[model samples]
Target: MGLGLRWYHFALWAGFILVMALMPEFVSKGTLRTMIFANFLAIFAISWDVLSGRTGYISFGHPFLIGIGAYTTAILTKRFDVPVEYAIPAAIAMTMVGGTIMFLPALRIKGSYFALVSLAFMELIYQLVQVIRPDLTGGTRGMSGIVTLTRGAANGYYLSFSLMIIVALSMWLLMRTRLGTALSAIAMNEESVKGSGLSPTKLKLFAFMTSAFVAGLGGAFYVHYLGSIAPRALFDINFVFTIIVATLIGGASTIVGPMFGAFFLTFLLEYLRPFLPGAERYLIYGAIALLLYMYQPKGLYHIFMSQLDRFKKSGDDD
Candidate 1:
């Protein structure tokens, strides 16, 4: 059964890679640019999934970790003239360390209180970025003139797409392990995991660190790709909403679900832009999200899985 599961997983990803590889031949440059954003968004959403979706930790402040990565790399490369190669790795490590520190409060708190603490962390960072070390942070204007990883839509698309696929595949594999089961078990009931003699503290710490690592990696790479960083953009609640909603709408607990959700949300928003052309579009989008979330909190992935099951059953009968 394990072998079969591995085969199924490998086949799905292999097919996805084949399709992504071929997509450039048929799509326009403009569409490819949008797809690149989708890829980055998917990576970030998957990062969120490792902890919040899997362990029920519900981090409202993941942007805090992401910001740490972006800011660290940006500050190092811009102010210190550190090489990009070393700075990016340092950024990721900093994000994990910062995340572990932030998560210390969650060790003592749970549920709503934990969520609030995370939210506060994001706000705190936002304020600090504006006031602290205006020279290094570039003040309210933030940093521009940063280096981009690739030029043109095609190269950018492939880079982001490859990164997203690698991150998603690796995360999917991790979640299939016993550690994954233990994390999920803690999500279901922390007390129960403790009763089983497995420390929930240790498991939660593992989940937070893993989530931070992914978020940091995605965030650091993203800043370099865009070649810019700003506090308002990185630390916004709307950004948080998009990440969380994408994960939830895609089917929170599964890695693939958030990837699906990110693409779907990206395309949906892009399609709406021409029609509404303003902030009002978000109102409509938010409404749809709320309605769907209220009705089927499990998300589109759950619906897709159910439909697939029904189709398989009908085919078997025939």
Candidate 2:
């Protein structure tokens, strides 16, 4: 399918970019830092959605995949003396390879079995990095002095935000194409998609590869930006929960939803910091998430559309 870009899409994205570019003038450095995390989270959430969200495969092992990208680039740059340009792409390639290995199990298994296998993959990585090559992997302490792409929070914010926009815009446009329609159709009914003569295996593999590409790109850049990597933190279940909750709360199977969810969740945590400055905050946070999921399982994006449609119908009636 052609671009099918509309005037409203241009207007909306332009307005968003303009506001984000101007945000440094209004928000505190702390908020900027928070937004930076949100940007990365959006990238990760988008990665999750393209495969698991859109294709009916729930992957609980994203951090495992992301960690591969992060660790790969970090090792190449730190241990092998590779340039940033080459290191990043190499890391992405490794991630795709890792993703292919990850996808092999998916061909045979699905549903919770698929999710459990994915989780096991991540846990296996966590243990392997520490034991296999502690020198390169940095083991329990992890690696440092890695090259950083940006210096300050301001610069970091700009870099991350720009990357987020690029990935979001590209993925959104891609999903608007006929290939996107086929992928979503698989999610709805794989049997029907096969009947239509589309190979579900190929489509799923493509989706996994795309997701791996994103995870690799985002993970590689994130490590360089942070100038470090730690296995325990990267492979943690809490991190996976954050990603899944962000995607679910934002709206699964939609690019824009995850972007919004990341910001909203990040800001919500920020606001709660003063009242609950410790891990206890997650109790309240998780409660809110549960309530929202219970009420509107489709997430905030669906709610927005519902309201917009109601407004339109009201105007028509009037």
TM-score each candidate: 0.96, 0.96
User: Stretches of candidate 2 above 4 Å error?
Assistant: 2-4, 316-318
Candidate 2, residues 6-30, lDDT tens digits: the string is: 7978999999999999998898898
Angstrom error at residue 302, model 1 = 1.2
lDDT score for residue 89 of model 1: 95
CA lDDT, every model vs. true structure: 0.89, 0.91
| For model 1, the run of ten residues with the poorest summed lDDT | 1-10
Query: By lDDT, who's the top model here?
Result: 2
In terms of lDDT, model 2 sits at: 0.91
* Model 1 Cα lDDT, one tens digit per residue, 70-167: 99999999899899999999999999998898779977898888889999999998889889999999878889988778898899999999989999
The alpha-carbon deviation from the true structure for residue 62 of candidate 1, after best TM-score superposition, in angstroms, is 1.2
